[model samples]
Target: MSAIALRGPERVVIHQHRRALWSAGALALMGVAVVVAAWLWASSASDTFAGSGCSVENTVRGCGDTVRAFLDTELRFSRAVDYAGLAMMVLPACVGMFVAGPLVGRELESGTYQTSWSQSVSPARWLAARLAVPAVLTLAGVSVLSAFSAWAWSRAKGTYYPRGDWYEREVYGAMGTAPVGYALCVLALGALAGLLLRRTVAAMVVTVLAYVPLVMVLNRVREDLWPTARFLGGDRPGGDAWPVDSGMLTASGRAIRLKDCSGGAGDTAACMRDRGGVTAFADYHPASHFWPLQLVETGILLALAALAVALAFRVLRRRHG
Candidate 1:
């Protein structure tokens, strides 16, 4: 009945840390809102530019910048998929590295895990409550944010697929399906790191500098090294198409509108400009294998995270014992 103790189902030990919960929730919302607003503003600018009176041949500054950013925002992405990738890939990773920023590290710092473990509640449950509540909220926020990103990018002329050039880096996938799993895993990692490191700052730093990078960078590096490998998902973006089958240059290429970005056919279409759509370009090229590729790759990563988290539980129990 004190600040450090709570009774609940052994499976889910949820303590009421209203302050931490509120803070996490607020931070998550703000992070996602920033992406949403950036996308919307970009989308609106793109739309306005798409419709504005400015002609490319005209001698006026006109909607040049507006049109560029607008088309850049959505072009070739869905709201959910876009946001999902960002949330899952970037946000959750950051938060997951930090979720334990308050959870395990703080407990160890205050030496509360010691007191709590002495109670009937096992070390597992203590970490569970601390991790579970925040993990759930963080994953939920990730899902919402990803959904919006996908929507915002749906109208993009060229989409997020990289055809050629350096612009293909923007087209990432949705965080909803895969990100939830990742977020949970990240929470677990946070707890494990916090417990092991016994310092929230160190845990956070390690999570970001070590674990998150390890997970995130592999795909990128593999894409660069053995792009044709199926397991690596290659440089073909998020889909499973053979690069030979793709008429475009490579996955590393920036996104380019096949048509004029202004909606007309001729020279100077947005597609011709060769802007990178999204990182790892997952959208565009209708009916291609990108959809399946995105789903499968996301599944693999999330599963890895799940496994990591499960292992962390064991480690927590061991340490607690």
Candidate 2:
């Protein structure tokens, strides 16, 4: 019985993908955990941000700033997930990568591609169904997580890049739904690697090596295009600079000051004001570069996915011959 309508072995590949469904569910659960943590964080930090704990004794940055602009506002869904949502949005990629790698690569390693190779369906159709079904699931899971993140971040957009701490935007902007795109790209790479190496574990290793660089490059590429943020010493504490993207300065031309330590406020303490740069330089305005960077980042990831698909088809054609 010659059939190309995904009747026989193609269903098996799709089922293999489905067998990994628990990982996707776990990703969804992780999203819930992120939301809960955000609620707890906002609740506890609300009082502190609202002028309750403006002291040199506090360990948190901007503690003495006496700024609660966002805190005064109610916590809404948009604000809760927007920036913090990146954590959830990105979690699925890890799940998707590990899941995608084994779906067909394992079969190929076991010489199952041969069974399908002997069929009328062709390697192309086999790969297509295998990649498409799970990628769709990955996308759906990501969509939910991103929606939550966007809504949450929107609520507290004011806190996107709070003063003296530019890490928020860096984290949220670079780390958000961007990972979803990376996951799809990784899946494509997995399909290609599974096709080429024909070994599940080896293909996974290749996928990891290939995808990690792409992911890291995706983030750095965002910074590079935006003329704004950049990696600060490989995601660790050290000598690396991330240019601050404090929105455009007020029309009043009033310079926002970076305060200095008088040493009397304690060695670990700092007092900042919106006055001038007598103490230090004010944050750079990243407003101009933000979206440009985002677009660049998104484009790069999609490009990687496209390249993988293109190569997958090419390799499948070769295998067909």
The models' CA-based lDDT, in order, is: 0.54, 0.56
Per-residue alpha-carbon lDDT of candidate 1 for residues 237-292, written as tens digits (9 for 90 to 100): 44323332222223566443333244566544224335433322222332334444
lDDT of 1 at 150: 49
Report the Cα lDDT for candidate 2.
Answer: 0.56
Runs of candidate 2 with Cα error greater than 4 angstroms are: 1-11, 37-96, 117-119, 151-170, 173-177, 227-289
- At residue 122, give the lDDT of candidate 2: 71
The clash count of every prediction, one per candidate, is: 43, 15
RMSD of candidate 2 to the true fold?
11.2
After superposing candidate 1 on the true structure, give the runs of residues whose Cα lies further than 4 Å from its correct spot.
1-17, 27-54, 59-89, 156-169, 173-176, 221-287
